[model samples]
Target: MSRIPRLTPARAALAGDAAAAQAAAAPAHDADIPVDPQAGAFFDCDNTIMQGAAIFYLGRGLYKRKFFSSRELARFAWQQAWFRVNGAEHAGHMADAKASALSIVQGHRVTDLEEICEEVFDEYMADKIWPGTRALVQMHLEAGQRTWLVTAAPQEAAKVIAGRLGMTGALGTVAEAVNGVYTGRLVGDTLHGPAKAEAVRALAAKEGLDLSRCAAYSDSSNDIPMLSLVGHPYVINPDADLRRHAREQGWRIRDFRTGRKAARVGIPAAAGLGAAAGGTAAAVAMYRKRH
Candidate 1:
């Protein structure tokens, strides 16, 4: 929420278009990463792969471009604070965020949004990644397993993050688009909870992957369905529910907070550590700007 020069919608659209073109023109994937056709690893985005939600970064980018008003930004910040404090996804919070996002992009060109997402990743997301989780992704790539990011964030944002991280690909909420224009509608349910499991199942079938040979990781109990689908399941920086569940199920658990150790770290303590590491201070500064 640091004040940058405001952009008119027309200027922002043009800027976004240019950025999209640049991203499109770049290399698509890392050719050096070997791929195993029958096995793959899936990962969650928010809190699992990164410090905060990718969608929140997207909202920051859009707000800077003046896509929404200050009030909307405040609402977005409040929702983000809730997520940070709870360290879990709430149905009501996701719905409110989804509705607000869809309304903002209703008449926009798909390419334009993609373009802005590229910049957003560089500006707000690059430094927020969890090194431990990233190392796990690297381990998968080294083992010749296909790596994918599965999240409820828009596909374009997921795509950008995956591409930058040199992952195989990503699966995310697909917004209905026609002739390169957003229709403000979703093609199916957001890849959340059961929907995430379904998407992974469909992908496994299409890719001819053996589920028992695959792996999955997440931080929330909400992703239990998807995690349960794979033979190897790992929990990274898990929430309270997921931590207890992982303990009960005897799954591998790792927490990359301050001490950078593998243990049953409480989410509240993790949140406090994350804040001490700058997350809370940043949120406070953002909130103060509004007042």
Candidate 2:
């Protein structure tokens, strides 16, 4: 049997205070880490923990609902392509894409959307979970670490995917809901970049965890703020610029995608497939427009 290390109340208080200060300066909050006997490992979803974006698969659900037009889907595809080619511009493109997607889903009930997410996860997300990424998360779990998925995807999306993966918690963007129906507005700053860092801090404060001893993994330089919040930052399958930045920052890098030599190539290829699917839908809208 293995002996588990427990923090003394005095030591825990000191650690909690230190972590709180570090988190207060962050831009987003995650989960309240209670006195669990587990360490913490933060993970970025999208390309870091999966072969592609969950949103792309979830979009098929929306398409079936007539919530997305083929042309809109193509635009989403093009935006992803631009993000892959121009890594530095990813944040802007992501925000725009999310805004566009949300607009289509504005009038939906929260429960209805949840059910859709559930179906998408069962049918699509399960098959897409990358083996290497799952292995990394399993490593943390095996070591008694509470693995969390941190993403810029909406909370509803994150909740379903995280639950399916059996992760400890999920930190993602929040959409406003009024009386169980979506209000078509955001409740706070979308959980991205600095916002993600802030959310982590708030979560750490509530849970009494030490961020300095924690771990965070992601695939983009845009996640630097959140990654920097922790002591161990691993850049998995990073873009060219992010890879270079990680090297300079002394961060570890892992390529989760099989047979992919570089992040630039892998991301675009995966994104291209998603784009093509989206483009096919977009073509129908184009035809309708011309007619």
Candidate 3:
């Protein structure tokens, strides 16, 4: 096993609030647990590790490719913001957004999207890689923990990012494929909310990993099922509802946005501002829908 570097005082300070909350809610356990003799770490993509959803950025990229219309991109961004605020009530909207997003690339070769993912990963995502989250993943890697990127994004896109991050595996929502071409329809589970937990369980079982000893990190309250499955659950840069739950449940929280020596666990100011701005845009559209 490689030696995992200790967290910097700045990083440790950022996690202080979360550590305290966890200590109050439940006993603190080592985040660096050996699930198996060979197993490493399990990660949730989106806000947990990355600054934001890579798929969303990918959608923007598709817009640049002329695959998505300006109106459609606006709508997609609207639904995402609405979903983040309203939680599960926006499930239908999320489904519709995904359908529309995928419809934009219908009949396009998957290889083309794969190439786009490479560009997004290199240009957009590489710079936005959260340092604290990367450090956590690196710690797991050094500890001989096999890392996996589990997300609700399309499997092909997830695989591209996972490969770039050097993860051992990836499990994401599967889209239909016929004769090596995308049918632009989801063939299996959507891999969100509860489905994410189920997929993680399935992976653990397949890899002979002990779920009771494994660690899971996420940012949404919707991921409670998966977070509960692991022995150590670190809630990183959680949303409003998830932050409340994390406080109540004693989940550890880490704030990576502020690089400040004393940042708290709740949403960072920039993220809150972005969500507000995104929500305002969604509200305008939603109002237009009502009219």
List TM-score per model, in order: 0.79, 0.73, 0.73
Candidate of highest TM-score: 1
Tell me the tens digit of each residue's lDDT in model 2 across 90-126.
7667777678767877888889988898887767676
Rank by lDDT (best first): 1, 3, 2
TM-score of 2: 0.73
- Model 1: per-residue lDDT, tens digit, 155-228? 99999988766577999999999999888999998889999999999999999988887888899999999999
Clash statistics: count for each candidate:
0, 12, 4
In the range 76-158, model 3's lDDT, one tens digit per residue, is 67765664454322367657757875687678887887888887776767655655565455345434456788888878778
Q: Pick the candidate with the highest lDDT.
A: 1
Summed over model 2, clashes come to: 12
Better of 1 and 2 by lDDT: 1
Worst 10 residues of 2 by lDDT: 264-273
For model 1, the superposed segments whose C-alpha errors exceed 4 Å read 1-35, 261-291
**How high is the CA lDDT of each candidate model?**
0.74, 0.63, 0.63
Error of 2 at 283 (Å): 42
